[model samples]
Target: METTEWFSEDQATFGDRVAGAREAAHLTQKQLAGKIGVKLTTLRGWEDDLTEPRANKLQMLAGLLGVSMTWLLTGQGEGPTEPTEGEISPGVSDILSQIRELRVQMQDNVKKMGQLERQLRAALKE
Candidate 1:
């Protein structure tokens, strides 16, 4: 699955969505906070799901991120979709698909590595 689909609201936390949207918008945490008139810590909290924005702020955030407020809250409404380069050529699209596949494989490999490490440690302790 594409990274965008992998990180769908169903699979990701509110903070994860926020971070993803922020990155898609090409804004840093500090910059987003500044644009939204919040402190960096507050933005961090939102992105970490430690806190949520109020209604007004949420509206502002949705607008700034070019997504719907509902999407931000539930990922059900209009949220950021995978960006398509202007008239994506076939070659570029194919490469993008391959990249997504590689990313999934990488994630699986990482998980397997972690499991192996844990097993190794347990065996060494025996």
Candidate 2:
């Protein structure tokens, strides 16, 4: 069967941009699927442009891939320049800020996980 395109004249579908970015990151469908917590077949469907991701999933996917949500959702670049390493372009700065935020969140999650693990062990010992 012929696949219907999800986007219009001015807009690009969220799925296509996601698939392209994933490929650009040198990730396979299975790897992207694992990262996004989706099934491999579901990821393949997205890659084949079969359907769009839900709202929250889209945001999480964009965050995990380190691309701007605007670019991921609408294929529009947010006027940030691409620079070489340590060049500090405007876009790179924005990306770096996001990376720092993610790092903080990850550290918090690790601490929380450790606390939970300790509580579980203590309970089990009791």
Q: Best-fitting candidate, measured by lDDT?
A: 1
Clash pairs, model 1 backbone: none
Those runs of model 2 whose alpha carbons end farther than 4 Å from true positions after fitting are 1-13, 78-126
lDDT of 1 at 61: 92
**Local accuracy of candidate 1 as per-residue lDDT tens digits, 1-126:** 434343445455678778878988899999999999999999999998899999999999999998888788887777776666564576766775676677567778999999999999999999
- Per candidate, the number of residue pairs that clash is 0, 0
| TM values, all candidates | 0.62, 0.49
| Pairs that clash in candidate 2 | none
